[model samples]
Target: DTTVKQNPRYKLARVGKPVNLICSQTMNHDTMYWYQKKPNQAPKLLLFYYDKILNREADTFEKFQSSRPNNSFCSLYIGSAGLEYSAMYLCASSRDGPETLYFGSGTRLTVL
Candidate 1:
């Protein structure tokens, strides 16, 4: 099926430290999205990489940073970790269009 991949399924970071997450898709999908998921709330769309261009949701535009070095790789970078940063980070890739996304098991960031 889909080849989207995320690393370090579980991560623990200290307050004020930097956290970086990596994602790669062997499919070389046209768009890749990052989302933040908390317990009961809906998964929040954070940002996405469309080919080489990056688009972030306006409300979450400043909360996170991301980069796509090449078509197959994307990285999610958080400058300073906080308790509020603790959440499940989802990575997904879609081809043809953004309507259909194939997701990888999320990376859980726990700030302490």
Candidate 2:
């Protein structure tokens, strides 16, 4: 099976509560990624892990945070969900820097 799994295909949250999204990959890929994509916009890379190392995009460095509690699972945490945060959160896996990413259908977040 392809690696990567996410829960609650869709979610709705109030404007200020903390939001937690989950993802898992069974292939044991050393790398895992989390991206936020909005309608008609590019999938913005939020953060990724190479082994136990976490790397956040410079532009989004402060906007998002993530943790890989173990090799097979990872999470994207938004301390405070905002209206702007309403979008599709995608989880992907890649074996290395330049390769096709296997993605989940995504969890669409609606912040009201």
Candidate 3:
């Protein structure tokens, strides 16, 4: 199975503090993606990696930061946490793109 694993299923972050979420997969996929989801809203693509290359969405490019330290691991970093940032973050991996996305359960971040 091509499964993506995310750590810290739930996270509690203080306002203005930094928050970090992790994602990993053993399938050796060439691409990984990060998305943010909220109730009644569509999942928004935050960033993604094509092998060692990183790509961020035009609108959200500055709002989110990511790093793929290695082929099997990727991280989503939020420089400063805010109430508005509280949402379900999804990590996915695929051999290509959306067509084969294998998503993790997600990490729910709550800002206090």
Candidate 4:
């Protein structure tokens, strides 16, 4: 199985503090994606990487930051945690498109 793994299945963050979540895969997929999900709402695509190129959703692009320091690793960074930031963060990887995405279990962040 080409699995995507996320570190820290659960997180607690103080309001206004920064939070960082990590994802990694050994498959060496060309593309990696990060999504934010909330109860009763669809998952929102935050950002993605096609090789070394980063692409972010224009509407939420400024809300999150990410980096793929190397092919096997990627990280999602939130500069300031807020009450609304409490949600599930999902990391996925695919060779090209969403059709073949392999998703990590997710990290649930709770902002206090």
Q: Give the clashing residue pairs of candidate 1, or none.
A: none
Q: Assess the local accuracy of residue 46 in candidate 4 as a C-alpha lDDT between 0 and 100.
A: 93
After aligning candidate 1 to the native by TM-score, how far in Å is the CA of 51 from where it should be?
0.6
lDDT of 3 by residue, 63-89 (tens): 789999899999999998889999999
Angstrom error of the Cα, residue 101, model 2: value is 1.3
Task: Give the Cα error of residue 33 in candidate 3, in Å.
Answer: 0.3
Residue 33 displacement (Å), model 1: 0.4
lDDT of 4 by residue, 6-83 (tens): 999999999999999999999979999999999999999999999999999999888899999999899999999889
Q: Estimate each model's TM-score.
A: 0.95, 0.94, 0.95, 0.95
List model 1 lDDT by residue over 1-112, tens digit each.
5767899899999999999999999886889999999999999999998888999999888879999989998999999999999999999999864367989899999999
Please report the TM-score between candidate 2 and the true structure. 0.94
How do these models rank on TM-score, best leading? 4, 3, 1, 2
Worst 10 residues of 3 by lDDT: 93-102
Models sorted by lDDT, best on top: 4, 3, 1, 2
Native-to-model Cα distance after best TM-score fit, residue 70 in candidate 3, in Å: 0.8
Task: Go through the candidates in order and give the C-alpha RMSD of each one to the true structure.
Answer: 1.2, 1.2, 1.2, 1.2
